[model samples]
Target: MTGLRKSPRRLRIGSERGSASVEVAVIAPALIALLGLMIAFGRVTDADAAVDAAAHAAARAASLERDATGAQARARAAAEDSLHGDGVTCQSTDVVVDTSSYMLDVGQAATVTATISCTARLSDIALPGLPGAKTLTATFTSPIDTYRGRQ
Candidate 1:
């Protein structure tokens, strides 16, 4: 009767020694860059969503106004407030409201369009060839009350 003996598996350390180190050295920077890119895109996406919300709020505010001048003012204020409330700090923010439909006669379909444009600062994200800021824009339209009278 012979006893079974277990042998250890040999590791080929001659050619593969330090291979993992080399791989890390080669891939670390690329992985880091990819992470940075994803973060930048996420920031842009957040800013885009914020802009869209601001535009919708502005349009709705404008549509509820009685006069074009007041509508424009309300739209601008609503957009700025919405962006700020959402924590979207923009380097520059612009709100453009089209209140031409206010001139339409009563019982006619009227619409208010609001465009929100914002240049969001991206200093936190460090990536080559990527700008320090990105501009996000959104437009929304809201209808005025059909039976509302115009002054």
Candidate 2:
């Protein structure tokens, strides 16, 4: 029985010391980068929604006017107001209104289209592979009342 004694296993504790810290140090940067990308994507999506809303507002405002000149002016104002109210800051903005529907006679079907372009800021995030600014454009069309008179 004395010759059949088993040897004890080694703990190997020293060899594994600081391994967790090394793993954390190696993985931390990747995790941070992923989080930054998610935030940037969210911001872009929100900006797109804002631009779309602005376009819709512009088209609706234009459709309410009876003259081409009035439609253009009202559409631009509505788009600017919508963007400002939504808290979307733009480096530059452009609003285009299509008021050809105003030429249609009363009782005819017509539509007004509005396009809004906005440059949204993303440089503040400081994420690699992301553009400093992204231009987002949205277009919307609204139908004019068929029975309404147009100039």
Candidate 3:
């Protein structure tokens, strides 16, 4: 033997197979988490818009009459209709009407508040990072001054 050096041989732990599964395992969780976040954000955005619209509408209605109770109900309905979306379960929506002396008096301002709550349903899947679902709430407020065509 003339001073020869041996090179290390390459070893195959298994087959060229399990790599795909390993890659999927690593990426699936992140993908699921991202999807969940997107859905939650979308729901929150919708709720916020609905609440704002309801508040504004309620205030306008309240300003028209001496009593704000009826205005509150109409505003709630409008808010619900605004927030209607596909595959969304809406609940726990509250509309609050605050007025001076429980009535809208001429030259008196009243505050209208609208709250919208919603949840996105996400069933457990391959990724454990994503929980069952998520809940979100949004609120809006506006003030309107009572007006009577003339003194």
Quick one: best TM-score, which candidate? 2
The local distance difference test score of each candidate is 0.92, 0.92, 0.56
**lDDT tens digits, residue span 1-151, model 1:** 2345433332445558899999999999999999999999888999999999999999999999999999999999999999999999999999999999999999999999999999998887878888999888999999999998765
For every model shown, the clashing-pair count is 0, 0, 0
TM-score per model over all chains: 0.87, 0.88, 0.57
Error of 2 at 36 (Å): 0.9
* Candidate 3, backbone clash total: 0
Where is model 1 more than 4 Å wrong at Cα? 1-11
Residue 44, model 2, lDDT: 86
Candidate 2's residue-wise lDDT over 10-111, tens digit each? Answer: 336656889999999999989989999998888889989999999999999999998899999999999999999999999999999999888888988999
Better of 1 and 3 by TM-score: 1
- What is the Cα-based lDDT of residue 47 in candidate 2? 87
Q: How many pairs of residues collide in model 1?
A: 0
Kindly report which residue stretches of model 2 are placed more than 4 angstroms away from their true locations once superposed.
1-11
CA lDDT of 66 in candidate 2? Answer: 82
**TM-score for candidate 3, residues paired by index:** 0.57
